[model samples]
Target: MQEYSSQAAYDRGEAVCVIGAGAAGLIAVKNLRENGFEVDCYERDTVLGGLWNPENQHSPLYPHTHLVTSRSQTEIPDFPMPDDWPDYPSAAQMLDYLKRYAAHFGLAEHIWYGSEISHIEPVEGSRFEIVVKPAAGSAARRLRYGAVIIATGHHWVPNLPSYPGQDGFRGTILHSSQLKDGSRLRGKTVLVVGGGNSGIDIACEAAVNAAECVHSVRRGYWYLPKYLGGEPADYALARLQRRPRWLRGFLTDRLLKGHRELSARMGMEAPDHKHTDEEPIRNGRYLEHVGDGSIQHRGEVTRFDGGEVAFTDGTTVRPDVVVLATGYKPKIGCCPPGLLGVDGDSPYPKLLARMFSPRVETLAVAGLVEPGVGALPIFHWQTHAIAHWLHIRKGDPERAANFRQQVVSESAQYAVDSTGVSPRHHLAVDAEEYLAGLGRIIDTLEQEPAK
Candidate 1:
């Protein structure tokens, strides 16, 4: 392999391992490699691009799939997406882009594919041990790293909250994960549950072929168009959004107003959920932006009957099939509790600003922050943070310790973050600003001394 950007100063044994080769994981790998760190990426699948790879086991890529966010905002920092690719890249395009990235940087050899990580726990201070088993074999092997990153980004499992009478439904029901094509729903009445992007997309597909379609959401959502004018809707807001929080909120409000009809038609109501959910969007024109009167908007599903979906507002719709797009639960259980050097699910303080494991400062996690402006932007920022922290520890441990001291308190209450119903705990930082801050930190550390 070619020599890294920093060779002699690079720390060995202090090898870092990142799980999953998704968008965030790949970015993390690139940054760490640039710092001359010996990084190993363990991927459960045989390919790059976690959800983008369709042939891998239980991956996400369907004929109908297209990037919800535009290529400009979603691409990695150094590698600009190919000029020939569509403005909104497809899943296959993204997969190819990642493959190219790995090949260009000679990262494929460093990756151990088809290796499923079964468990992870902290060992001695500043170190972690991971138990991994090959997908085709029965044998398990233990590998230790200076730090292990759980870039195994979310969406691994589907979230199906238990509700009344779900078992009573006689017709076939599938989660968004299983519904790869709209062919089966061609002549059937379909009811889509949820208000997120996936739900919106699924409904769009079904309306094209289904006998009829209904979109059900608990409350209203403000959705942004994928594109406005010729660029991404969120791309235009980049300038106006840099203002103070109050001013940013004003711009957010104006964008939602433009998409109100489309949002309402797609089962997204007004007031509570602003268009684009306050996320930045590219302004582009779309046909049938509204539910088209073909996809009816019904607020929330109360329960299910033999052939009926009841709602919280005492309304009910009889549909042939229902597709639930509820989100997923973060799976930290696979990792041991003591990994944090503390007991419980709460994140560690005083370590890479609560981005890495404090118990094992070498260990880091990317893609944990919930989507701020979709998953890619936030995950990109997280990957950047992990990489910067690794560089600091590699050059000088004492200097890094001082920086770690700044984050000793992760929460205002010194309380641990839980997965329960709380938005603030997950989305503490503005994602775009966080990425910008991350870039600045890397630049700063590159100039800082080893003292």
Candidate 2:
């Protein structure tokens, strides 16, 4: 449990500090470390594998969790899934895979677990100070890094919405981020609100274990299969031989649009969420819940009285525990209250195209976005691009302007998806977008870094 000796010299090159030892951070660190940068990874959790590890601190997120995304596409590059393993590896297995990745690539020595980075501020000029709080007896420490990558993937903070009785409720209420397993909810009636993947998973878990389960959604969503012909749906879509790229986009949109049209006809809610509606994530398993009947759909939580949760349809239901499978708020520390120009009223952390803080420079956030492809790949792509631009190639004035413009253009092009939908992009759409982004990063690195 020893620490690396602190250096006094500023010319010791850059310490590329990455936050969140999750999938994205691990990938970023592995690549940056291999690229010969002095990399330090920070994770608040004792164990690695942010989403893969199951802990009570996280409840229902643990048990019965099989990855919906295929093992092949989900794994890190150069690391293939074992043939003997199931198509969709369980959370425990994914954790094992991550452990293997760390060992195989010798990333364990570079990572500092249970260490939470509190802030990344411009100390004086281009240099940045990364302040972190060690998990235990160690006092706070600071490292001066020339560049920092906020690969602290988006899902850590729970995006829960406040409801009427949330405060005075006698029952326990928490978000999916707080969900670890179904142990505590044993025999207790649980109410899961939201229609995302987490909401569906929690409802299924509750149905199997809880006394009674109810799920409410403000609108309906389109559900797609995780795989087609034994390959991931996303992978299959990419390899579609019969269609051209334009046709694929057209056909993809048509298929999604068709599902929405059909859902509306069947007395079920359609793809139209609120106009200001939080767009449904690109996912599998929405209609499956209705078919399974695990979740009794209440319209929406109109209000609540002590033990009863009233719905928008004027019906009332009382439950022992109310779990807001609602989304997570971005975990930005004590910073100024500001908003984005794109979405003026929203907070500052909501970046455009996952970069361009619009105010902060030498500080770039890479993983707050959601792409159709998956956070696994998109986050790495973002970190790869942001880290390269900020650390490895910071010197060129013209290139920096171009980088900023590209980010702005990318944000505008994807603005509909970002501003209209949730911050994350659908995985199917994101795969290609991020791959292109990564390619651009590779191209940009040829110039000299800002000294």
Top-TM-score candidate index: 1
Highest lDDT: which candidate? 1
Q: TM per model?
A: 0.84, 0.81
TM-score of structure candidate 2: 0.81
Score each candidate by Cα lDDT: 0.66, 0.63
Please state the error at residue 245 of candidate 2 in Å. 4.8
Tens-digit lDDT string for candidate 2 (1-451): 1342364423324777777777777887877775667888888888777767775134235456777666665666557668799867787887788888888888878888888876556666656676677879576676777666666554656666777766777778877766666786789888888877677778778877888888887766655556544567655655553588678767656545654554565445666532112323333454555556665777779777888888888887788988888765455552233422234545435565655466556566655654444355565566666656654445565777766766666654443342234433331234455466556655766545455
Per-residue accuracy of model 1 over 1-451 as CA lDDT, tens digit each: 1221222322236888788888778878877888777888888888788888887667745447777766776777578788878878878888888889888888888888898887776666667667776889865767777878778765666777555788998777888878877797899998888666677777777777888888776654445677654456656555556689888888655655557665555445454532322332222222263434777767768788877778877878788888887755555544665654444544322234435665667676687654345466566556665677777777777767766654443312223333323222343345454555555554555565743
TM-score of 1: 0.84
User: Candidate 2: deviation at residue 291, Å?
Assistant: 3.2
